[model samples]
Target: MTFSEKLRELMTARGLGLRELARLAPCDSGYLAHMREGRRIPSAKLAERLDQVLDAGGELAALVPARRARRKTPKGKAGASIARRDVLALAGAAGLPRGLSGPVAPELADYFRDQLAGHYTADRHLGPFRLIPTAAAQYDLLCDLANAARGTLRPRLWSLAAGYAAFLGWLYQDGGNIDRSVYWHDVMLERAHRSNDRQLVAFALHNKAMLHADLLDGQGVLELTRAALQEESALVPKVRVLALQQTAHGISLTEDGDARDECDCLLDQAAALVDQIDDAYPWGGACLTPHYIDIQRATCLVRLGKAADALTLWERIMPSLRAAGARRDAGVFLARQAQAYAVHHEPEHAVTVAGEVVELANATGSERMRRELSALRTRMRPWAKEPPGRQLQELLSSMGGHT
Candidate 1:
């Protein structure tokens, strides 16, 4: 059922009215009513309050989709024929390079749309680096389109081009191509700057900083995060909260006394704004929770040599981590798990987890994960005399069964 329908059904079951629920929720009745009717989406804050009022389970009250009748598709042989033709047309025209006439040749635009759809479909078919050519072609097309546009079309084309660049950057990052990711990120940033779009610029800067954070660059992380937070007036409150989170991540890595203190204060402010903040979750991942904060806090504890405290926090958060689909991408998440385990002197568990990660990395042929696994093995090399460590080293060299 949709959130609205669920809300209505739950209220009726309890013999409660909208006004009563609103009073208990301590939010505006009109807003609650609108939410019930699907006229509006409740902010996280509002949803939390309503969930409390309803004595509901978790934050999933809004996750249910209202039931709707599925539309019937044509099912005759002729329908299949038409579908085949449409697919062929889409495939034939998608991803063509643009011409010099300024506007992306219509064929080129068609090509871009096709490539985007293809990129998402049957992802295993294409390798990560293939996106480089696809993205480069689209970028050229967008530039031509921008140059060709006059008056109204000009701004629209520019926006499309900028958005396309941002998408390319996202693809590169997800594909584990950091160098290419930054290149496109820079392109997107420049486009956003040229377009005078503060929000877009904020997005670009935040994403760029995120890439650096992923690489564990302390100074780079701090610098870019500061740049993100510096535009206080220009950023929405939610964006500001994210900048704070990024700053916190950087501080966790640095182990600086003053910076750690500042991050603690910043996190305190972030926690207060939690309910008030709009959606600023990165990558739509479940890590966008208080649990994620706890995980980072745990990491900080580990860096501070408070292994006992860190271990407690890790144990607490592991369930959430498991629930967050960490097992699905066993290559990376398992490696991270191994890292956590290794640092805590649980070499046996780390070795076991590393084995699983290496197997997945080999299966996926992900050099990125393989590299990470290698690094972890090197760290555990000191324990080479131990059977588990020795086994881990051998596992690292040839992740696949060939060795």
Candidate 2:
């Protein structure tokens, strides 16, 4: 039977409606409907998810056609040579294998881990556009390697693939491609489960929560972070710390009367945990610092409409942020600081900070920064004719009329 027919039969047998299946699959109902009607083919990743959700085992996944191979490059030519070069340099080898038919090297996983670390550092300074192509190519390479790998190497490669997928999701989110971001995060969660790594699983869920937080979906963030924290006692200190701070940010966005107080309590918990963390795992350790917790607390304060309080935190953190060389992050923080200035009725200061944000947004191609500036522009509409407001308007207008 066709995949859709089989899907429909399975759903009927289980008394599952379209929306119910979508929820269980954790995807959009409309996308599920299209798949049910055979208007679209499920990607291998989605097919795997649907199979598990419907308890079809391998039967459903079997229907997904293999992805078409990319067009062949010229002989002795490598596409995305920079990433390949980096891999070779890090691996200290002449070249990686072109295909997975040969026995994969056990140390290849280590090479990928190192490569991802470099990518993380680059992403801080270079943003997504310059890095995504190479990153995506490397992720595809990891997936191919994992598929043909066996024994102990298989899970390691899968874990690395999950990490790359999560990084791609974050990059897409920063670049404002929400749909692609969510898709990659789902891919990350699936691979994380396959790796049988509980810490990775928790990290995947928490990372997805970060995406929701960016979208200002307070309840969505809360739900995902809570799920991440379900096994908090077993998680590493860093994971717990990250989840706590994210949970605090979510609470601040909520309508709860005690949101600010709850947020503060959560931040305190996270900060205390930060002291227990070591540098063994560098994946998120950089963000588990006390200063990072303070940044998150500042974000929560802004969400809670305590603009002046948020500005105070921003002032203390701004110098350290610049010193850290995280240009994209600094830009995002500056945008928030600008918003606080506007809310505090410091229009001139707001405009000045916003102008800096606009430059960073253009330089970094950061949609998140642009979105922040857009919101600031809306808030400053009352002062549109004023010199400071007019300057802000012109700045946004220069960004393709995003105002």
Candidate 3:
């Protein structure tokens, strides 16, 4: 049977309807319906998800066609010139060299690292939409440099490339481009393994967990974070702390009766690890801060339906967040606060907070904030006809509505 035929048979065998299968695959039901009608082909990632959801083993994934090949460059010198030109194009966008010649200098890797640091700072204020092009270019340039380097320099270049890849992954995720986010994250994991850097490996795993967290895939977050902590002794304090906090986030997303308590335990462990981080470990970004752990704790409290407790934590952290001038992060915190108000039966307060979120989301063009606003809009549906709920809905609609 063909792929659609096989899909239909599997669904029938399992007594799974379109919406139910879509929920299990965590995809759009309309997309599943299109696939069933043979009007659409699933991407490789979606195919894999479908296989896992339907317990079809690898059969569904195997049905996905191979990606089209790029056009071939001419052999010898011509091909080399073409490749060099492409790399130079990426370099130009990344604010690097205009042209390539011989071996990639070791100093270039250091330059990339410094540039990445600047990009991180820029991302906090500017958000992902404005930064994605530059970040993607930088990642591409690093990939070219890593491929050209040799000996000890090679591994260092690969490690740097992995860092850039991870940043690009985060950018795409924040921009709401899930497919590109997954692609860049997978690239990061590959480059991390290529560098043979255990710490980088753990960091990559942690990043993937963050991606899952964005999707609210609790099990996925828990699994990846657990994998990240398997060699906890080998991780830097910062990475370990990040993994711990992420694990707590995963617990909060689950339906366990003791999720709040479990999350607190994880956060407490993370809090202890935070004190051990005396140096600026490069990987965790703003998450390296002492307040970050508490932010995660508050986020978990919100997820666990302890809105009042979350509101208390938000009140404590909002001053520091404002002082830090992390515009994108501030928007996220505000959105969460809005969620807390909605959950606590304070619709007017939720609308007021959501209005602030709309401004920040516009300023930074942060899809992350939009996503939070979307969830808030959904939560406020019970009061939809009321003025506060209608105001919140209108604010969200102004920001492009629910995703």
Candidate 4:
């Protein structure tokens, strides 16, 4: 696609207006309009900034040609000949050749692992649109390392690759790109097994199970969670608890009274297991806190038609969420709380909470949050003519009708 077309497509996907993109890119909106009309071409620098602003994954930048001062390298790429020569001189002074300065897989692995933690933090606080490109670039670099690594470094590199793949799968899922998510999960499973990282293998399986849960595949959720739990060694506390929780969720979706009993029992067991988590280990449990489990439990309660119980639990959980993690998740929970209130006929409370959810969704540009809140609005349709309901409808409309 032409640079203009790609930019437009990305803006639409990310729900950005031309002025919004231009303002965020710190460029002239008129220049952008002219570029779209093919009257003017974007400079490479502008293309790069646009790519970053739109999270286009370099799509815009790739379509633009570099001005030749011989040739220009993009940011994060090799510098000019002078820079390379300076680097070579420094390496010579250090008694190490330029070639010998190539990446050490162990170091690369550690770097990727550390970066993964930062990526996770970003995932919590930033929307997928802001971070997906960075995540993909990190994964691509890890793949390059995996190809060149040998022996111990090779396995280590693969382990890190698997980690990034799993992370990419999650990023894609949050971005509502399910096909990419499935592809990355399968890649994660393969690489995890190849690297013999038992913990990661279990993690990948549990991730797949959670995906199945999202897809409303109760049986698939059960199967994958069980497979995760059946790993040879004892799984990490968080991983084990997650599997148990997924199993409970899967069972809760079924109509069997006996399964519901099992669901409750599993949840109780999972709660008790939380105390066993060791803080010293680098546990990947960003969403596995006691509070998170309680939130999940509340969701199950609502699923079981116990909206009042869910409302009580939501109230208890609300005070603790200090806007620390994903705005998307926070917005989602707020919408759920609003739903609980709505279902319980607390129109004022529902409308007030829905307003908070919608505002957050708008601020963060989180489609997932918008979708959840929109569903809540639909659920409140019977009360649409009520004062609170009418207020919420107006609020949603003012925020751009479609979720």
Better of 1 and 4 by TM-score: 4
Q: Which lDDT tens digits does candidate 4 get at residues 101-215?
A: 4544355455567767777777767766566545555666566557666678877778778887888787667655567679889999999898887777888888898777667
lDDT of 1 by residue, 252-368 (tens): 778786765766777766555556655422221223454656665665555455556666776676665556543324355456556667777888987887877776565555545
Question: Candidate 2 overall Cα lDDT vs. reference?
Answer: 0.80
Error of 3 at 113 (Å): 0.6
Residue 242, model 2: lDDT of: 82
lDDT of 2 by residue, 240-269 (tens): 988899999889878599998899999899
- Counting clashing residue pairs in each candidate, in order, gives 7, 0, 0, 0
**C-alpha RMSD (angstroms) for model 4:** 7.9
Best by TM-score: 2
- How do all the candidates rank in terms of TM-score, highest first? 2, 3, 4, 1
**How does each model score on lDDT?**
0.60, 0.80, 0.79, 0.71
Model 3 accuracy (lDDT, Cα):
0.79
The residue pairs found clashing in candidate 1 are 1-65, 1-66, 2-65, 2-66, 94-111, 95-111, 102-144
Q: Rank all candidate structures by their lDDT, best first, as comma-separated numbers.
A: 2, 3, 4, 1
After aligning candidate 2 to the native by TM-score, how far in Å is the CA of 234 from where it should be? 0.4
lDDT of 3 by residue, 81-104 (tens): 243445565555545454444466
**Which consecutive 10 residues in model 4 have the weakest lDDT in total?**
78-87
> What's the residue-level lDDT of 146 in candidate 1?
67
Clashing pairs in 3: none
In candidate 3, stretches whose alpha carbon ends up further than 4 angstroms from where it belongs are 1-101, 278-281, 401-403
TM-score of each: 0.59, 0.77, 0.75, 0.73
